[model samples]
Target: MKIYLNDQLVDADEAKVSVFDHGLLYGDGIFEGIRLYNGCVFKLEEHLERLEYSAKAIMLTMPWTRQEISDAVCETCRANGLKDGYIRLVITRGVGSLGLSIKNCDKPQLIIIADTIQLYPKEFYENGLPIITVPTRRCNPAALPPTVKSLNYLNNILAKIEAQHLGYQEAIMLNDQGYVAECTGDNVFIIHKGVLITPSASAGALKGITRDTALEIADELGIPWREANVTRYDIWVADELFLTGTAAEIVPIVEVDARKIGDGKPGQITARFLEAFRRRVCVEGTML
Candidate 1:
């Protein structure tokens, strides 16, 4: 395997970063998880745009332009001979002293890795997954916005731990105001009476790329979709439930908190969206 470190590609075992890097020391960094499909990158521009937006939100200056980042991603894929895989693009605060001040860092570091990823087992997707809600509320937007895909994921990790201990595959977290936020690593969606609904960005959910793609698919299929502030009760009584992310793509949730969703099976609309999503990614993406 090869990793893209700055402008050069190096063997995975040889790739390294400074131990004093603020990204590892203080979790001061942003990242994006992208998918490569059949020698093409799925929604590459959207992911790069989000990455830039996240960096700007944190006032972290990226050393490369979006076009350069895109070229590096494709270069990394070629270096590793990766035709179908996952891409992790990271920009860190670089090496810094033991301090919280951003000025302590010299320059931001860039790391891009192309590798295969399967976030869930085949059975999970085939039979659908059952999940539970956790007590770990999402971080308040004023404190640390959920929209930024930063390296500090302890908040979501804590909720994920609770779910794992309870023998569940995933966990759902609510915002400080008790509105549904999202899952540990995916965006939540529920269908009701032929309508697809998901939490808006203002509701503390990360603006997911796959989530937006799913909405586009819904529109193409003539399925009504909307964004709103949803509650636990809405999920409990939902006609169908699903999750979307760069890695997860679209996965049906058969049950939530012991309540079966839509006959304890993946609903017709969920299946339709999943199928359409798969078809779209195959042809509608940037070739490597």
Candidate 2:
């Protein structure tokens, strides 16, 4: 397989970065996981926009223009002979000293990797999966804006740990205000009174690309959706629920905290959205 290291493509085995990189030491970086479908990159522009926003919010200098980065990501798919695959684009605050200061880093680094991704079992979508609430609260917005998809992911990792310890595949985390935030790497959504609801940006949820696409589809389909502050009580009584992300696109959640969702099966609305999402993957966005 081939990897994109800045402007050039090289063997994955030959990819290297300095140990002094602040991205490794202090998580001074940002990244995006993009998807390619049938020679087309799904929501490529949106992903790039989000990446740019993330870099600007974190005060990290992207080493290249948005167009350059987008071209590199598409080139990566070409190099891997991929018609359908995933792209991981990473930009790091280049070599910095041992300390937390960023001055030592003179340049930023960019890496793009194209590969296949399977975030969850296929059966999960058909039968749905169970998720439990974790004690790990999301970072307070005043402390760390969750909108920026920065490299500092220890908070999500801790929540994942709690889920793993309980032998569950995923965990739900609340914000400091006790409002439902999101999952480890995906945005959360629940169905209440035939309406789709997800945590608002103020509720500490990442504004995910897939989440945006789903919302658009919901609107086009005349399915009502609202960005509100969700609570444990809201989830418990939800008729249907699902999570969205670049990796896990519209996965159904059957039960939360031992409470069975509507019929404990994939709800009709969830399935309809999932089918629509599958169709969009191949037909939407920029074609390479």
Candidate 3:
């Protein structure tokens, strides 16, 4: 496999970064998980925009232009012979001393790898996934904005560990205030009283690309939807529930915290959103 390191493509085994790099040392970096479909880079521009936003939020300097980064992504996919796959684009604050200060950090480094990823089993998608609510609350937004896709993901990882220890495949994370935030890696959504509801940005949910797509699909299908501060009670009584992300796409949640959701099966509305999402992937955004 080939990896895009900085501006050049190199053998994966040869790609390396300094141990002093702030990204590895202190998680001083941001990243985006993107998907490619049938040679088309699904929502490539949107992903780039988010990356840029994340960089700005952290006051990190992006060394390349949007077009330059986009071209490199396409090049990496081509080098890996990837017609359809997952892309991980990372920009790290370059080498620095042993302290938290960034004064000594030099340039920022970019890395892109194109590979295949199946976030969940096919059977889970068909049968619907059961998830638990973990005790670990999401970090306070004031402490670290949830919108920034930073490398410091230990918070979510801790919640995921708690869920796995409890024998669940996925888990939901609530904000510090006990409001439903999102899952370990995906944005949460539920259908109640014929209305599609999700946590608003103020409620500690990332403005996920797939979440936006789902909302657009809802509008296109004439399905009523809105964003609000969701609670566990709302999910318990929800007619249908689902999660969305670049990796997970749209997967139905049949049960949450041991409470059986509508019929304990993927609801019709969730199925429709998934079907429409699959259709859009093939033809949307930039093609490699």
lDDT over C-alpha atoms for residue 41 of model 3: 96
C-alpha TM-score for every candidate? 0.98, 0.98, 0.99
The lowest-lDDT stretch of 10 consecutive residues in candidate 3 is: 198-207
Give each model's whole-structure lDDT: 0.93, 0.90, 0.95
User: Which of 1 and 3 is ahead in TM-score?
Assistant: 3
Q: List the residue pairs that clash in candidate 2.
A: none
Which order, best to worst by lDDT? Answer: 3, 1, 2
**Model 2 local distance difference test score:** 0.90
Flag regions of model 3 displaced more than 4 Å.
none
Best by TM-score: 3
Candidate 3 accuracy as TM-score: 0.99
Residues 214-240 of candidate 1: C-alpha lDDT, one tens digit per residue: 999989999889999999999989999
- Candidate 1, superposed: residue stretches over 4 Å from native: none
List of clashing residue pairs for candidate 3: none
Cα lDDT of model 3 by residue, 1-288, tens digit: 999998999999999999999999999999999999999999999999999999999999887999999999999999999998999999999999999999999999999999999999999899999999999999888999999999999999999999999998789999999999999999999999889999987778999999999999999999999999898989999999999999999999999998999999999999999999999998888988
Candidate achieving higher lDDT, 1 or 3: 3
